[model samples]
Target chain A: MVDWLTMTIQMASLAMAGWCLVSTFRDQPMLVPHLVGMGLLWLLVIGQGVVSAVALIGGEGPEETVMYVSYLATVVLLPPACAVWGFMERSRWGPAVIAFACLVLPVLMVRLEQLWNPVV
Target chain B: MSDTTAPGRALRTGPGRLLVAVYSVFALAATARGTYQLATRFDEAPAAYLLSVFAGAVYLVAAVGLARAGRASRRVALVSCAVEAVGVVTVGAVGLLAPSLFPDDTVWSGFGAGYGYIPLVLPFLGLWWILTVHRKDRARAV
Candidate 1:
């Protein structure tokens, strides 16, 4: 996993979470802009995933390969999955769902980092 | 949220939507952890892993029941939430008193502290949301 990419995803996810929180408080439903933002975030996550996958194929990965890959798959899929789920709802809670997913993304990235580079 | 018990205003709108999402995540997390442990390290801790899988199944049921948004599913979801609440407390207590019983950390171990204690709080939230929706729907119908 690229360090800069991981940092970028975390920052972007938090920013998305903040934006969605504002929308939730303002009683605004999920709009096109939220979806667009999620789309961009998903693209970034996919990039990180691809890099990790390539590295793994090249035999540079943690010992807990299965757990790490499962987590990787989850991180890659989460944004788009939540975006679709949230978009289906036509209420302020739609953005709330996105916000929750966005918040989780950062934590998952942290976990990924630990898995990728466990410290002695 | 037009405050109507309309068809479109099903259980999976508003707060229910968020609940469903959270439940789905837990379901995935618990099920994954349980299955992975059971498959690879079952000899180390069978009971704990089983409980994890069971909890995951309950979460899955609750999520589906809420997302489906019908009277029957509501009942299903309600019962599962009750079961989940009881399961967490019982497991948590066991972990505290008889740690040997678990021998490993399940989702409910230490009241879900492993998973940031959300497992402890989730059932109550689910109960509140489901009951609230039922009461509101009934009140509007009347």
Candidate 2:
């Protein structure tokens, strides 16, 4: 279940990132779609964070606790922070920021997976 | 609201602000991670953890300086970026040469290899952006 949600979120983020890259290159405003994509992404990240936290408190291994917690915190904080920063920049760069944020999502997901399955 | 006006005119507006935002995020994350690692297990890897803390401090100072947007702030940002660039390169080289020095991971470990080399690239970008802004300001003054 968590894996499916994580995959969906990653796909959505990738799509948004592609859109943002195109929009930035084409000098588009990127106010609407970026906002929508980012909003959804934020919700997904928060959900992941909650699930991870619950799992952690429910006697997850301490060896991976710190890494999981740190990653969760970053995921929770990233979207809103990017939103504020993107909104501040009124140029095509606004979407560029969104693109950068989107790019980070997949990398973060990869890291999360590594933490979840250390042997792999 | 003249677009051409210089000095104290929003240093971190437009695309530049995005850079600042990214830097700020890194600053906060690195600081928190470094602090946690240091406090919890200093004996495990003192060198790596201390470098992490220093990297975090550099990021924080750079973010603050860029966001402030003044002459002094520009200087501070420039200096911070310079230091960050040197630190990343030096630490990265050292990490590669002597893996034993870092029993654990630092942000600059392997030239930010864990973080997609963004740490290595970020300082250069930051320095370029700050210098570009300064150049624009100087042109306006002249």
Assess candidate 1 and give its lDDT.
0.93
- Model 2 DockQ class: medium
Q: List the residue pairs that clash in candidate 1.
A: none
TM-score of predicted chain B versus true chain B for each candidate: 0.94, 0.93
C-alpha lDDT of all candidate models, in order:
0.93, 0.81
List model 1 lDDT by residue over B1-142, tens digit each.
Answer: 7665553246788888998999999999999999999999999999999999999999999999888856788889889999999999999999989999999999999999988899999999999988888878877777
Q: For model 2, how does the per-residue alpha-carbon lDDT over B36-142 read when each residue is reduced to its tens digit?
A: 88898999997788888899999999988888857888888889999999998998898879889887988888888977898999999988888887787788778
RMSD of each: 1.7, 2.5
Q: Name the lDDT value of residue B9 in candidate 1.
A: 44
* Candidate 1 regions with alpha-carbon error over 4 angstroms: B2-9
| Per-residue lDDT of model 2, residues A36-110, tens digit only | 879988898888778767877787633667777777677778788887778667788888888888888777887
A88 in model 1: Cα distance from truth in Å? Answer: 1.5
Best by lDDT: 1
